[model samples]
Target: MRIRDTGDLWWKNAVIYCLDVETFMDWDDDGIGDFGGLVQRIDHLADLGVTCLWLMPFYPTADLDDGYDIKDFLGVDPRLGDVSDFVELIRTARDRGIRVIADLVVNHTSDQHPWFKAARRSKDSPYRDFYVWRADEPPPTHDEVMFPDEEQGIWTYDEQAGEWYRHRFYRHQPDLNTANPQVRDAIAKSIGYWMQLGLSGFRVDAVPYFVSGTADDHADGLDDPHDLLRELRGFLGRRRGDAILMGEVNVPYEEQRRYFGVETRTGDEDDVQGPVGQELTLQLDFNAMQYLFLSLARQDVAPLVDTLRARPAIPRDTQWATFLRSHDELTLDRLTDEERQEIFAAFGPEPHMQIFDRGLRRRLPPMLDGDPRRLRNAYSLLFALPGTPVLFYGEEIGMGENLDVPGRLSVRTPMQWTAERNAGFSRAQPRRLVAPPPDGGYAPEHVNVADQRRDPDSMYTFMQMLIRRYRECPELGWGEVEILEQPEPSVLAMRSTWQDASMVTLHNIGPEATTVTLELDDIPADTRLVDLLQNGEQVIGKDGKVEVTLDSYGYRWLRISRPESRRLL
Candidate 1:
């Protein structure tokens, strides 16, 4: 799994696994997951076909806003082990074919940081300009503040400095002033420190909030953040030639191209688009996921297909990191309240939806009780989608959301390795769970790695089989996607071909059984189609028409090739 061995070397065919190190493993029984604990799980990740491990922030923090409130960029959070532990985890993961990507929070630092402490002491301090501050007037009020209920505004007044500093997120996490040359240089040096340690890459958090406009204006302005990103990329590129630096630029799809340094029309007056430097390796496809979820809940597959067809063509080297669940909010803001209510009505009170505040919570289901078959169909769609797939920590074992717990902590529960006490996560008492279950009832039988591994029909096994099959066919890894225009709206059909082999993924997502007729006029006359999921259960007519009978939500990947060509080979 050397970086150079892969074609694009980006997350092209990579399967990423997201882990919250603070809550992932607890090796010392202190009720906190540490790097040594993560190092212990390296083999599990490799066995699960994970090529890259994207860890949430593991830096020194105040523990108020999870790990996002960084107190020290150079040091690891003591609760999650020290520098030695991180280095060991990196070496262990790399040896097991896993590239580790850490979270880089450049937008802000914790108020507890030494630099912030020095800046707060005096307005004339050398570190005063490290963060965005205004002495003449209050800081800008961007749109409606992110936490209006919790805070009065985006800027907080400092009595000592007699000025207000900008903060896009929590007030404790003050936004860094990227406009300052010294601040930029210091951040670059911090990145270089990690690069020198042989870490794979980074996931830049809240990249667009690096700079700000006026107090009355919420606009981000025409100046792309690429100037800062490019400077960081250039410095890192010089040191580590092929390492990646993905930005969490969660903007509109049209604005995504700018991250790749491509200038295009933004449909606004006097707002010409400019390039944001950096290869634009990956942009989280929230729009695509939104469209898919909406279509599924409404039972209208046309919109999903149309959205995929209308997607802007990205560079061959670029890729979308697809996921059904991640460490973020589950319900995206793209959907209207009406749509959300409709889904809740149909799905019948999902645990995560109980406290879902305007769609700002992420949680997994405890079990596939309602529609296990439909869940399997969704998994099929995820794996067959045209992007690198990312599996959330407990998704493989059908881990459910404990909505009883507050915030996104419910979704960040420990990995259920066994049905033992604490689900084999920690040796601590049941009441000591960092994210305790709402009702104090553990889902020992329903959600555990040992039980699922022994069950062949488990979601974990299904995912493993799909990944193994995908690896067996290199065409599916890197090939052109040609979606077939099928008459049946509920069926998703696509073809991936390379050289002499062609792979067709057909899925029936509808509630009723359907038969798909595929004309072989375009294909070779002697071509033989082999169903990988259902062995030899296919019928091909002499009139060059292949009829496939699929059960409700059934899917199959057909390996189509000429019989004579296969025999000769």
Candidate 2:
């Protein structure tokens, strides 16, 4: 392991784009996305101003759970590419200033994994402890199980071993016995292998259940993954300097803050920026995301305001990964039943789009019915919110989902590059393709990159404009966020301050046009609201208040800089 305090912190100022390799592009005509295709398309991401790429998973697997079920940790999936292709992809991507982070799915492995296969052969096998096994009758802990939609219970009877095994997700994926020293060592070794592969870091999957199980079954006690996370953080730091561990802990803001190393593994224990250990460098802000959709669903902004107000403190080095949608369904579990129902009725009216009883399996464009204004507002809010923003694949061009695909696979369609067959993704026949692209209104012929690139008012261009503005205004990501006091319940207001710069963003969540008055007493009397987009401008009134008029789903981002004499331009 190598340790160095590079202090690069490139992720803090990065625009991250997340995608699955199998769904991005196909280079070999093998009917699947591959490293060669991704390499060929690196310029597209670079042109979009993406500073980092968060890949879902490209490891060898049984093609279950979107590559979360790992068959080999150190090698690349033969379908995607070999080791040389991945290394070349990284090198080429780096040349364009885009760092890559692959998914880390250590919580469980496919039953087809060598260790699991070996362990099932006999209880006396040395690999037996690599996976959790229940000698006695398995406990009834369905309430805490992660995947209630797919799994029945935590234990599965393996006839080969004559014992029951624990699995938090699908039955084929057995939970790894992280409590074992050898198992822990193997996990660490996997990390080292990837680091040596020249990866920047990993996006940790299923963090909450990483340390859960019987006390003897876990190196750390049940339901507490802090120690393992800390160990992983330390290992990352030592093996490859400045590599980050972005965790997927989707709890509310208060509980989610613990993933950033501010809280301890034990009960209510914590140390503020302790020197000894650290946890995840980045955690997805599920609180903001859940409430973002809720606010939109009810056409009310209170849910979002409440979530932002309840935000917890994180270490200065830590950041929250902001996103609109991810690999799985967009879950509204954090909200109340009534609130979730309101959202489901509005966005996911058809029951086919909902999953896990609290999430929507569809993408944003179709959910909003392709209303450009609302989509722009939501995307604007995501970029303007605190922490680093994570853009999902094809979200930039307003890609739609395919409900025909089962489970959460609805959103995992092939990238529509052109209007040609297979959306210019592959030359293989439709039957040989991995997963079909959207059909009907969202089909490649209707909505594709080739069409949007020529249209100035397209979502593709609008996303580019958003990214340009986001990069131009660093305060939105690196500065402090303060919720503004506005009388309009439909309008959400907030201010970001950093160094000598301050920015204010106002978003209207309701369907009706309205005017809002924000109390700007704290702002200097001479400061003016400069529209960063060069579209509109307003001056502070002598009464220490600012009035904003917005359309049904309008949003405004204003920069408050002391101009020449504070006079109106």
For candidate 2, write residues 1-569 as lDDT tens digits.
Answer: 01122126666657999989998999999899999999999998987889889988788999878888899988899999999999998999999988999899889998999999999998889999888887788778787667797777878888889999888888889998776777778989999998898889999998887745566555355336787888889899998877999999878665787677774434444444432228998888888898888888877788888888888767767788889998789988888898889889989988888898888999999999888889999998888888899999999899999999998989999999999999999999988888999899899998888899889988899898889888777678778899987777878888998766678888887788888786778776656788875487778877778777888888888888676423232
How much is the lDDT of residue 113 in candidate 2?
A: 96
**Model 2 residue 93 distance off true place after TM-score fit, in angstroms:** 0.9
Q: lDDT of model 1 at residue 281? A: 61
Q: On a 0 to 1 TM-score scale, where does candidate 2 land against the true structure?
A: 0.94
Backbone clash count for every predicted candidate, in the order shown? 4, 2
Question: Model 1 residue 251 lDDT?
Answer: 63
lDDT of each: 0.72, 0.84
Q: Which stretches of candidate 1 lie over 4 Å from their true place?
A: 1-10, 136-142, 147-149, 212-223, 263-277, 347-357, 360-370, 437-442, 499-501, 537-544, 564-569
lDDT of 2 at 164: 92
Model 2 residue 275 CA deviation in Å: 8.8
TM-score, candidate 1, is 0.89
